[model samples]
Target: MRYVREFKGFAGIRLESDDIGTADDPSIILLHGFGQTRKIWEDVAVGLEQAGRHVINVDLRGHGGSDWPSDARYDFDAYVEDLRAVLGQMRTRPVVVAAMHSGWIATAALAEDAATLASGLILVDPQSESGAQSVRACAEELSASVGQGLAKPDYDERLLDIFDVDGSGARLLDSAPHINIPVLVVRGALGSGHRAENSTGYADAFPNAEAINVDGGGLLVNAERTEAFNGLLIDFLERKQPRFIPEYRSGSDARTLRDAMGCFATGITIITAHDADGKPIGLTANSFTSVSLDPPLLLVCIANNAGSAETLRSAQSFAVNVLQIGQQPVSNLFAGKGEDRFAGTRWEVGEYGAPILPSSLGIFECTRNALHEAGDHFLLVGKVEKASFEPRRDPLLYFRGKYRRLHFT
Candidate 1:
């Protein structure tokens, strides 16, 4: 739990995360639901860090570890003012805003001025109370609930305490169409307040935005089905991951490898397997190419990572799960750091004893067809296993080191 430096003019809890990377990295500021604190985001922070993003999950005013103002004026402007202060200390313009419940209130307050403050907005299932009467009644109920908790002071259970079933409504959801930032609304499958069309309404309002519905779990979804939620979040971020041309490359300076790869756009794949010692391992490569129509066979080139590569060379059996567009984060997870990436990801073993993510464009449970030496990586061929794919949603295509979302404008 990090303390946020106070804004002299504002009076509220300044909860912060120590996501101290470079000052310029895009940041996510999470606002907890009403009656909750920043602690609810612990697992989320871990997932975001693994995906290489800084996250700040904070306790709003009148909640855990934050200061409650003596002023009874509980209007949202005051909350927005508090956010302004937090954003002031935060780096650069166009920050990302993620809000749930009461945090949605703060997000809406800022959406009217998004170009001035944020690049994107993510609103979790929010309260959507419409009329002034509903707002007044909801405000009274909200005040009493927080007052009761404040009177006691032993409210240590942040999740159970804050998420005690207030349910969502329009009282909290601003006229979403008025929100100007690119928005991503996340709803739990159960106990969610915002209806499906409600999100669509918000999406329609914003010219450059989309909405996603998750089924793994409600308001308690993210922590419940961490893997599915993580996968979905990862997929979303990868599709949204900024495409930037880096200034320098280590080996070849002239044409650059990325530029060369750009010439012949290819499919990217991250292959994984256990070593002879039965330890999990994986690596990333863009050399995954389709080869054949009648039999349906695919190929992957694996670098000499301690992971399944060695085992593949020896066992000659593995599963190839072709990733759809925006699955780059999962690929990175399998390719990059951490000893427990599999634990957080959902997968099932194929008949051949290889693990594969449940949803993939192609699933190849094959005996090692052949292996050949490549430059530094090995070409491991796999025959088709039980394959499945969601038609219309295209697989991600890469070339010259850029990921493009295939959609007709």
Candidate 2:
């Protein structure tokens, strides 16, 4: 269950938050980064609640549902004080989870008395310091993550002008030693560049802290590697701030098992072929691999209940279109229901008479070689008749049930 709750922040500002789960359960306060709202934590909140934690997903002073100050006081101190006030208003000391820029606020808020204000702290893709260039890069990333055409931007625009990113980093480093609580720092691919050394130093400043770097994960770790992040979060919570001990029996939870399997990352592909009537049929799939090189063989596992499964299984020829980063919409269209996937996409017939996406990173036109039933899915093996690829493009990636892009850091 989720309810809207309001809290008093610095100077009596109304901070809006989604109060989820039972109040009796241990509480978790979620804070999003700059240019992002509490909506980012919607999925993470549900996951935390399911793992027996009460979640309070909140909006900062000038973002989302929270009150935007008339005077435009978007400085670092204002944010820190707002968080401190929110903690003071809470009935229970909750484990505070902050991401990116908000991590600095959370750190400063709990610096003086972390034990009294919060149980534990978790920072996602945090940076201890930032310069003007870093701030601009963050804004650019936020725009790219949604789309280049986002017209109405979230949060008060004054924030960018008012907050001193360069000074905030140095102040956060000064405050880190004062915060002596259990801390977990999660770094993504973005952490490898300008913030790598500084983030490591920040995490080490904590008296009791551990850090984990996620490979191929972007700055938005919770959004990209959600399942993996949740797993790490819950595990950290259980170990550091245990309320009740729970043991998991093997094969007990299907969700747990599925989440475990999601850790193994794979590249996205679209399996395309024509039906008996010569109509194009395709579906998005990540269950693909190169089987052998001697005879040039490959295989893709299709679920038995898929709409195109039967057609693909008996098709004399088929094509695997390895998607690039720009083809996420195409992947979603093929994976969805009641859509003319081919009509919306630009594709052409391959040399082997199989439909192929013209803009794909790679294309494998093949003829049916073998088929094998494997539980709920069947493996369709094919002899590669022709293979074409574009070396300049980066392949689309999938991990932890979310679309990913190759991030070279």
Candidate 3:
């Protein structure tokens, strides 16, 4: 059975998505390219559902039934944040399947938190980080191809704004290495956006990734070669192990389990709140994810040993500032023991009375709603009161015991 659903995206924009197949089945999330809506994945979703897989097709912000913000922010980070919000609401971590520009969004989102967000990744004819000129040329070509009748009424001309934005290039080169999950890169033989060299580079970057070219297929390989694409997808799914799940058994080595959990890549964040004395307190945390949309809730986990844990737990409000690629030092400073973290860091009090770090990829000013003790950490749930972001910066990442930056192809 198939059903339509709507979810709140970053900044409270409503996103239209379709859910197909049995709820208990393995899930595959499909993302369409620029200027396209979820409709593009209809055929592919049907095929996957027939194979006993649950398929979800989503219309990115400013397309289809989704709301287009007045800010006209159609940059890469906006798309990535939108996907992150959608994934947060899913009952199961899905295998993300993306096309062209959407592939970059998938890569960024997976890079942020692959363990909780996605099981596997499939990138089809994804745009290469070939530079601004190449992106503009591709966008122009796509705009022309859409013509007039083919375009959706809700399609904003600003959807092509990504071409002019800096840092719009795919960060797969840097992010792939951190993504320990299986990845499949599919390119059409004559695809304009994907070049053989770029595909090779992607495969080379990922420790567990492969590239495939579909014969006689063009940009929309899944549509042009539906049967072939479906066959390949099914084959890849069969070969990949089921999604990784943390197994805690009696007598399991705690250190060994911690090492295993580190395999999941995550983006860095500096969670800040004011203490009872009105002193600002902040600490670096990667255990953060959106929890609900009805009330706009998100949660971050703070270890019991963290110096700021008590402050955050008791504060009426806090902010989660997602670190940018240039904020490694800031992450380190907050992560370290005894030094004035905010003394040298550039920051200002947000409207919600939480410290807002400058140049962060995104910021969530939230009101602390609930706190629960889980193991040795405290789960602080917050109802987001304000949200903002920087469109031109890539996220700082942590994976496998090291800091990493996005490598634009």
The candidate that achieves the highest lDDT relative to the unseen native structure: 2
Instruction: Name the weakest run of 10 consecutive residues (lDDT summed) in model 3.
Output: 145-154
- Candidate order by TM-score, decreasing, is 2, 3, 1
lDDT of each: 0.56, 0.84, 0.79
The C-alpha TM-scores of every prediction are 0.49, 0.57, 0.54
Residue 62 of model 1, lDDT score: 59
Q: Please provide, for model 1 over 306-394, each residue's C-alpha lDDT reduced to its tens digit, 9 standing for 90 to 100.
A: 45566778765677677778687777677676557778777776677767676666666666677888877788877765566567557
**Candidate 3 displacement at residue 344 in angstroms:** 87
Residue 130 miss distance in model 2 (angstroms): 6.4
Candidate 3: the clashing residue pairs are 174-407
What shift in Å separates residue 18 of candidate 2 from its native position after superposition?
A: 0.7
Q: Which of the two candidates, 2 or 3, achieves a greater TM-score against the reference?
A: 2
Give the range of the ten consecutive residues with the poorest summed lDDT in model 1.
154-163
User: How many collisions per candidate?
Assistant: 12, 0, 1
Backbone clashes, candidate 3: 1
After TM-score superposition, what is the CA distance of residue 283 in candidate 3 from its true location, in Å? 73
Candidate 3 stretches with Cα past 4 Å from truth are 131-140, 143-154, 162-165, 189-198, 217-224, 241-409
